[model samples]
Target: MSCGMFDESRDVIEYHPIPLWITPFFFAGSYMKKRIGKTSIAEHKKTLLPSDEVPNYFSQNNLFARLTYLVFWYLYVMLETPRIILYSLKKKPDLFYGYEVYGARVASIAGRILRKPVVTRFQGTPLKINEQRNWNTLYPHGVLGLKSKADAVIMANDGTHGDAILERLGAPKEKIFFWHNGIDINFVINTQHGEELEKRYDLNKKTVLLSVSKLVLWKRVDRAVWALSALKTDYGVNNAFLFVVGDGTERAYIESLAVKYDVSDSIHFAGAVPHEKLWTYFTLADIFVILQDVGNLSNQVFEALSFGLPIVSLDDGSTTGILKNQYNALLIKKQNIETDVPRALAMLIKNKKMREGLASRAKETFASSVCTWEERMEREQKLLNTLINNEHKTSY
Candidate 1:
């Protein structure tokens, strides 16, 4: 089971080569499924999870409300556990794989009953905000046991998240594996959406700066707006424009910041473009900026690299391990967001040769390293096969 939103209309499951049986906690329905054509994965009956339609005053800060919310989800998982166990018994799956913390707990329970090895992939720091807040604690008695119970705990990145698992969850070192996210290079290279967007947005002859991610507060999209203002005012980058793709709760706030900075005209908020159609925006970009507070490796960074776009990001765990300063990309110190982000952007905007050099090296790095979706899946498949074959059972 995966916790991520699986909207068939916007997201394409075909990119994932593995033959999956997805049981998403939240799904957009059969109408969208039919539109996307036959998916590579089989869809299971959607889980009856609690909806996020709480009253206005029912806030996360309220202790009673938080506990009630947690209890409701725990009960929901318990209700679904029987179905999971029965399904495992009937299908006899080689292994049980869960995507997030909630799925991990459910799969772990089912795995123990069936005595099958369980693998849980933590897409982000487990028990972090916006998801389960107490996943580290064991359910019912509220003890710490989820990480210890899993046969193997996979992390999407080996940066901040991996460190959190080791230090916070106390996960065994050997039990952890880092599977960096990968991109569809062939799709990125071949897919093309014509100048319809470019013409509509008046992108021609403008130095295009792109940032693609959900418009969330932690993402610090306001920083992009500030940088745009800095570029024009301090750096004399009049022809440059920042295109922010993706939407979230912070849309109005971000727009307000743009107005305050007087870069509203320069910063184009291209709200939530379809995932399949993102290649067009990628093709249209000259440089990519990711102003996330924690610089974990993002899918947008991989997509930008696949298109050979020069990237400007902060020097932190999110980008440090993957991007090298003055090599594939430029990494600014976090303290220097005000001085350095604009400086870096201005430098890239003015220096055509430097931009091409960084972009070229970035593409080369992705091509030579583990950057393709097929390679990522291959590693995961091998790991699953190893666990199923019971080879080096005690090693993990």
Candidate 2:
């Protein structure tokens, strides 16, 4: 089953093509459906009512919101519950899949009731929410109830998230899987670099250190700038430049920090650019550095790897999975909230062997282990087939 809001993209595709780019890139995968479950009908039994949307504020703290979400989720499963009983129940699809944790948890119960499988994909900060937060006890400890019921879990980050699942959710070993979000490597690398970008930023033949992401608190982009500044002062890195990509709430603050540090000329904020044009930054950049503290994985890091650029990043949850100490990346740390990112970059520039070795290994990792659109489909199809076939054999 899928969440109803996911289909919201169809409305965008119909209304505005330009805005459709904002839709989640993976929504195209909705076409590949096995079977979804539904909740029980206490009312008309024969009719399954279509669900409605609830606002974000309602979901924030109200007890009714929690109960309604749980019940409607079960209702969703009731619409598809029969699919598990009969192997031929493929004429109509099952319940809708919800994208959030609350909806996914309720759907897990529906999966157990209907003997159908459920899988939840993680995209944001892994396991950080399991601690004693404002809404801590709404679900089970570490959200184990959902994990126990779910057939499998899909982690967008690396295997580092496996700990959060096991410790907080109490998920079994066999139930967890990893999917490194990747992009079109060759297509991105082959794109023509915009000459204007090079000339405007004075990045011609300069060893460019790139940071392409939203300007936000946890991203710690200031660390990258700090490193670049140090590289220039300590190592006489006159040939180096920093290309900052994307715009966000913290744009003004970041720019102000650049000026305060007296490295404004060395740093250039390119702002938000189209996806096609984003590749040019990679094409022109010599290295990429990301220091996200929350999410275990990022699209920017994948793009960097796809373009065969060496990465320098902090050892946070996002990079802890794929970024080994010295293999695929130059992993640094934040000492008392002050990162040694500059030291990491300085070492890389001094040792060309380490830089080339990291780029080579990252490319290999993307080709063999990272998941692409084709690979995701095949793996998902195989899992669904196995789940469906097992049900058939049990019935016989």
Candidate 3:
């Protein structure tokens, strides 16, 4: 049977998205001790909920994952589908909720069996109708037009992308809503330092630039190497060093790029740090930079803002203008990254006053515009309660 904490007081059962559980870019601990039963469940004023993870693939092992999926995922789903059904039968949850495709599909199957409402949070880009849905074989329901099975669908990150906006994902227009995940920063979460990291790196003396993300091909971290080189070659800012925080398939290429650009000495390759401890690097950074394929506004963006670091990122309208030039961040156009990244980094490094100004504004923007997890989840809870009530009336 599925594992979850039943809240009799609230009449709700939640499969809380285990903190970046599947995000290999963050930490392997998401799959390790960070999971529920392993860690002590702290009491919350609100009801405590149980969470679980169903990993799709390993980080930095995409191609290998695809090849092994035939052998692994089939057996994986085979075992899970039955447990999900049995869990639903045993728990008789008022409703079922899911995190991503795998969890969502399993929840859908359980809901169909129990005739309960299912709400799913789907963040990945939508697949075309004609495109083969590989996940079809993984679950019992085939998962074609899964949105139809879900009572409510939550699309991550503003949901304005072509697939989501055009309804190409086949989600009923009415069932859809948008909610970006919120950060948990009340008073600058990282007030401590990583001692070993401090001894190993010359972060205190050097002008530190930080970039945290999966070093995937699409993220284009190679361009950050180019900027790091520019800080030396073009701008002649020899004291500056770029600390890259992540590990992925592109790690080799990025390492090679650092050597190619002759800035190998100036870049620190701190492979994936534990999520809770990442704030150590954040507190140590002077500026945050990224050349993401999508617009800026990932978890790192908020973390940087909270840490009061000025941001230099590329925006492609994918996030619908979450960042503004010179107001909260320095936004680079996709077409101008070759010029924009170096220029932005150079400018921030040269002018401490402006850098501090932007950093201040970024912190202010986060305080004024952003919602914490408590606030966002409160809204989500209200929605779930409303949906349950509406379905109850409909049944009557």
TM-score of each candidate? 0.77, 0.69, 0.73
By lDDT, the candidates rank as 1, 3, 2
Off by over 4 Å in 1: 1-61, 126-148, 163-167, 188-194, 200-202, 391-396
Clashing residue pairs in all predictions, respectively, total 3, 14, 0
Please list the residue runs of candidate 2 whose C-alpha ends up more than 4 Å from where it truly belongs after superposition: 1-98, 124-126, 129-148, 158-163, 186-193, 316-321, 336-339, 392-396
lDDT of 1 by residue, 19-61 (tens): 2322232232223333442222112112211111111111212
Question: Across residues 176-281, which tens digit of lDDT does each residue of candidate 2 receive?
Answer: 6556655555454324457776777777666788899887544657667666667777777667788899888668867876786678988888899777778888
Q: What lDDT does the true structure give each of the candidates?
A: 0.65, 0.56, 0.63
Q: What lDDT tens digits, residue by residue, belong to model 3 across residues 1-396?
A: 122322335676656332243245224333432342121222320221111111222222233233343333344345555776776676667777766655665666666667766776666443322334544433223233244357777766632252353255466667776666688875433444556655666666777888898976556677778788877777788888888999996698779878877998888898898777688788778998866654356777877888788888766665454567887678777777667678888888889999999988888877876788898889888877776666452210
Q: What shift in Å separates residue 99 of candidate 2 from its native position after superposition?
A: 3.0
Better of 1 and 2 by TM-score: 1
Error (Å) of candidate 3 at residue 225 is 1.1
Q: How many backbone clashes does candidate 2 have?
A: 14
State the lDDT at 184 in candidate 1.
75
Number of the top candidate by lDDT?
1
Give the distance in Å from residue 395's predicted Cα in candidate 2 to where it truly belongs: 17
**Which run of 10 residues does model 2 get worst, by summed lDDT?**
48-57
